[model samples]
Target: MGFKNFRFQVVLRVALLVVSIFLFFRLDFKSQYVGTQLALGILIAVQTVWLIVFIERTTERLIKFLNTIKYDDFSENFSSRGEGKIFDELYQRYNEVIRKFRDVRSEKEATAQYFQSVVQHIGIGIITFKKSGEVQLINNAAKRLIQVPSLSRVDHLSAEAPELAKQLLALPAGQSTVIKLWQGKERIPVALYVVDLVLRGEDFRLASIQNIQRELEEKEMEAWQNLIRVLTHEIMNSVTPISSLAGSVAADVQDYLEAQPGEQIVLQREETEDMCMALQTIEKRSQGLVRFVHDFRSMASVPTPKKQLFEVQEMFRQLQMLFQEELLQANILFLIDCRPEGLKVLADRQLLEQVMINLIRNAIHALADQPNKTLQLDAFSDPDSRVVIQVSDNGTGIAEEAQEQIFLPFYTTKATGSGIGLSLSKQIVRAHKGTLTVSSELGKGTAFTLRF
Candidate 1:
C-alpha cells in the first residue's frame, strides 16, 4: 500500500515501453520516411533506459540503508524528501533503527562510566591483571597503597616491594596472604586476596589489597589482654591462698614450739626442727609462686606511651654505658650504627629503652657459647622511610618451633629465662604502635627487628 505511487509508475513505464515497441514494429518502414522510423526506434530505447535506471535507483538506496546499519553509523539520517510513499516509509524505518542504536550506545556508555567511578572510588585497593602479569587496571587506591609511580605490569612492583610482588603472583584464586612492609613512618600489614576473573574468554586475576596492620594490631592486643586477664584471675586466686596459708603455718609452728604448759603440747627438739624446715620450704615456694603469676598484671596494665622525640644515637650511647662492663668482660664486640646520625623516633623513651635492653641481653646470652662473638646494633630508616632498629648477633639461632612460640608469655627456650621478656617487649612496642619481630635460623644467627 505504501508503494502505491511506485507501482503506478512502474506499470505506466511498462505500458509506454510496450506501446512504443509495438508502434515501432507496426510502423511500415517501407512506406514511412526513414527519419520517422529512426525517431520511433530512439523513443523506444529511451523508455527502456529510463525503466532500468528507475529500478536501480530504489535498489541502491536500500543497499545504502543496510550498509548504514551494518557499520553502526547512526549519524546517517535518511530523508526521502517526498520521493514516493515507498521511499518515505523506508527512510522512516531507517531513522527509527538509527535512533534505537544511538539510544543503546548512550546507555552502554553511561553504565560503563557508573561502574568505572565505583571501582575508582572504592576504599579497598584493586588490581586487575592478565595471567601473563600485564596489568589491565590499577585503581587509585592500589596506586596509593603500593606507592607505585606507574604500574603497567604486576611484576613492576618488584622494584618497590619484592616479597609483595612475589606473593601476589604466586597466590591462587580465593587465597590470601598477609605481608608486613613499611610505608613512610607507618608499618603496613597488607593482606592480599586473589580472585579469578575471565573477561571475554581472556583469563585474568583480580587482587584486593588492604592495609590490615591496624586490624592485626587490634586483634593481637585483644588476644594478649584476654590471656593476661585469665591468667591474672586464676593464678592470683590459687596462688594467693597458698601463700597466705603457708605464712600462717610458719607462725603456727613457732607458736606450737613456744607454747607454755596447758597452752599446747610442747614439741621435742627433732620434731620442732623438722616442722620448722617443712614450713620454711612451703612458705618460700608459695611466695615464689605468687610472684611468678603476678607478672601478667603488668601486661594487662601497660600504660599508654608517653611519646617524645628522641635521637637513636643518644639512646644507644646510654645503653652502651650501661652494658659496658658486661660486654667487655664477655669480650663480645659491640657495634652501634646510626645512619644520618640524627635519626630520631617518636615514642616513649623509657619504654623503648627497656625493649632495647631486653633484646641486647638476649643477644649477649646467645653469644655466650660462640667463640667469635659479634653483636650489631643498628638504627636506620628503611626503604619506605620507616624507622628501624636492629639487634643482631652471630650466635646459635633459635629452632624453628621455638621461634613461633617465642612471643608467647611464660614460654622460653632458655633455662634461666623468665619467658616474659620478649612478650613484654612486644607489648611495649604495641603500645607505641610498633611491631617487634624476630627472624632466626638454626646454626646461622638471630635478629630482632623493631619497626615503627
Candidate 2:
C-alpha cells in the first residue's frame, strides 16, 4: 500500500479501538448491557493487535528478502498471493531480482570451467609464475616436459636441468631460447617463449614451452636420403666407363711394348717407362673409382630403419672410443657435449653411427695441418623438439660455393676425395627420416647437424 493510504488505515483502526473502549466503559452493569460491553472489550483487544501487526508486516518482509539474497537462498521464493496488490507487487520484484542473480552465478561458473579445460588440454606447455619464481599455474604439457607431477616454484626444475631452470626464471618477456633437458633416458630440446602480464595489478610471467627434437631428426634424414639416390645413379654410370678406359690403356701399353724389338724397346726405354707409369696410374685411378662406386651403392641401398630408442649419451661414448686413438695421434682435441645426459633418439643405431663417422672423418681431414684444431660432438634437442646431433670443427672451413654440392657423390674439393662419403652419410640420415645440414665459414669453421 502507499504510505499515505497505510497511514489512513492505521488511524481508522485506532479510532475504532478507542470507540469500543469508550462504549464498554459507558455501558451499565445490568445483564443485557454487561453482555454487550464484554463484546466491545473483546473487539477492542482484537482490533488493537491487528493494527500493530499490519504496521510491522512491510518491514518484516523487507528484512526477510534481504536475508534471502545474502544467503543465496533463491529456492525460497516470495509469495505473490493473499497479500494486497502493493505487497504482492513487492514480493514479485524480490523473486525476479533473485532469479537474475542465480543466472549470473551459473554463467560465471560455466565460463570458469571452460577456461580450465583449455588450460589443461593445450599441447604447448604453459606456466605462469610471479616475479619471485613461485609458479602460479602449470599445464599438463609443462608437467610432462619437466617430468614432474607438480611445480610449486621455477627453481624445482634445477634438479632436472640447471640451465633450464635459470632460463625459466630469467628469460625476458618477448624473447625465446632453446635448451636441452633430459627426462630419464631421453634428452629433449625445448623452446621457451616468455611474456609478461599483469592481472589484478599483480605481475606474472607466462612461458610457452615445446619439444622439437623429433621434427628436426625426421626432416634432416629425408633430405639426406634424396641426395643419396642421386649420387648412386650418377656414380654407377660414371664408374663403368672409367673402368673400361683403364683396361684399354693398360692393354695398349702392353701391345706397344711387345711390338717393339728387344733392342729397339731398350733404346726407347725412357718412353716405355713413361708409358708403364701412365698405365699404372690409370689402373690405380680406375680401381679407386670402382671402390667409390661400390660404397655409394651400399649407402644408397640403406634398408628400412630398425628403429629402437637409444640414449644419445651412449652413442657419444661409443664415438669417443672409436676415434680415441685416431684423435690422439692427430693431436686434436675431441670434445663431447651431451647436455642433460640421457638424450635419446628412435633410430637405427648402426646406420646413424655410420653417418656420424663419415662426418667426423671429414672434420678430421679439415683440421689436418691446421693449428689448434678442435672437434666437438654435441647432442641436444632443438626448439622444434627434435633430437639434434652436431659435429663441429675449428679447422679449415669449406668454401661457401662448395657447401651446397658437397653432399653429392663424386663432387669434392680434395684431389683424392671420393665424394661418396658425404652423399652416403646423407642417405643414411634419410633412411632414418632425419636431416643432415651443414653450416660453414671459409675462415672460421664448419658444423654438420643431424636432426632426428
Candidate 3:
C-alpha cells in the first residue's frame, strides 16, 4: 500500500510541477513583479531535483539487489528500519529470495558430502578416470581392495593385477569381466564393471571392482569340500576292507599253488593256477582304487604358495634342459624366447615349474599325431610391465567341448590320463596368485598363457 501511495505521490508531484511551469510561461513579467517571478522559478527547479533524487534512490536499491544475486552474495541482508512500508516490503522480498538461494546452495553441498562419504565407506571399490587413464577419483574401498596406498592412474594397477590395467582401459561401457589376482599368498578373483559418464561435456569412465571369490567362491569351495569328504569317506570304506581281504587271500592262494604235488593231488593244476590269478587281480585293482582316492584328496588340499622373485630367463633355461631329451625323441621343434631379457616374476619357482612341465607334456602328447610339430615357450613384459609367459604348440589342438572341462579334476581326454594333472596345475598357478588360460582351435594350435 505504501508503494502504491508513493507512485500516486510521484504522479501528483509531477502534475503540480507542470502547472507551475505553465504558470511561469503565462506570467506577465513587468518591472514590479520581477522578484516574485524569480522566486517562483527557484521553487520549480527545487521540486524537479527532489523528484530526480527520489527516483534515483529507488533505482539504486534495485541495482544493489541485482548485484547481490549476480555475485551469489548470500551474506547480503535487506533491512527496512524506519523506511516506509513500501521499502520495507521490497526489502523483505529481496531477503526472501536470498534465503531461498542460500537454502538451495546448502542442500547441494550437503548432497555432495553425503555421496562422498558413501563412496569412501562402501565395500566395493570405485574408480573414475578420464579416457586417457588419468584417475579422477578413487574411493578408500578401491585403495583397500587393491592394497595400494594411492593410485594416480589406471595403468598403475598392472603391478597388482597383471591384465586388469589394460582390461579397464579397453572395457566397453556397461560391460563386466573377472580378473584373477593375488593378495598376499591367497588368490582373489575380482569382478570389474565399467560405465560411461559425460560430465560438463567431458567423457569419463567409472569402474567398480569387487572380490568375487570372497562373495561367490567361498560357498562353492565349501560345497566342494563337503563333496570331497563324502567321496573319500565312502570310497576308502568300501575299498579298504576289500584291499586287505584280497591281499590276504592272494597270499594264501599263492602258498597253496606252490605246495608240493602230493598236497594238491585232489585238485587239478589248472584250477589252482586260475584261483591264484583271480585273487591277484582283485588285490591289484583294490590297491589302485585306494591310490585313486588319495590322489583326489591331495589335489583338494593344495598348500599355500611360498613366493620369491626370480628371473624368467633362468627359469626358461632350466626348463629347456629338463625337456631336452623328450623333445629330441619326439622330433618336436622346441623354441624358447625371453625378450628384453631380464623379465622377472614373484612366485613359487617349484610350483611354477611343475605347471610348465605339465603343460609341456600335454603339448608333446598333442603333437604326437602331428606330422610337423612345433613347441614354443615365450616370455616377455607386457605394456603394463606384467610378466607374460606363453607356451604354444602347432599340433592337434584340444577339442572345443573338452577345453571347457580341461581344468576340472579327473577330466581328461587321454586314455592313460589320471585327469588330475591339468587341474592340479591350474590350482598351483592360482596358489601363486596367477592365471593359466588356454586358447586352442582344432588342428591349428593351442596356447597356454601365464600372467604374473
User: Best by TM-score, which number?
Assistant: 1
Q: Evaluate all candidate structures by whole-model CA lDDT and list the values in order.
A: 0.84, 0.81, 0.82
Query: Compared to the true structure, candidate 3 yields what TM-score?
Result: 0.59
Candidates sorted on lDDT, descending:
1, 3, 2
**Segments of candidate 3 deviating more than 4 angstroms:** 1-225, 247-274, 381-386
lDDT of 1: 0.84
TM-score of each: 0.64, 0.50, 0.59
lDDT of 2: 0.81
Candidate 1 lDDT at 247 equals 70
RMSD of each: 7.3, 11.5, 10.0
Worst 10 residues of 3 by lDDT: 213-222
lDDT of 3 by residue, 1-452 (tens): 54346666688779889988877766777677788788779979998998899778778878988998899888888876534677779989999999999999899999999999999889889999999999998998778667788889888888786687888899899999998665543345789999999999999999998977534534544566577788888887877666676677668667666774455435568866776776777768777887888777977787888889999889988998999999999999989899968878899998899889999999999999899999999998764477889899998888878876787778889999988898788777767666676778888989888877
lDDT at 356, model 2: 85
From the highest TM-score down, the ranking of the candidates is: 1, 3, 2
lDDT of 1 by residue, 1-452 (tens): 43346777798889999998888777777664668778889998999999999889878877887887788777888876555776788889879988998999899999999988999899788998899999988888788788876799878878788887897789888999988665642346789999988899999999999988667767877898998888777776776666676777678766775776475586689867776776777778777766776677777787789999999999999999999999999999999999979999999999999999999999999999999999999999976578999999999999878876788888988997878889889989988888887788787789888988
TM-score of 1: 0.64
Q: Per-residue lDDT tens digits of candidate 2, residues 273-367?
A: 76677677767877776786677567557778899999998988899899999999999999989976988999998988888888899899999
Candidate 1 has its poorest 10 consecutive residues by lDDT at 180-189
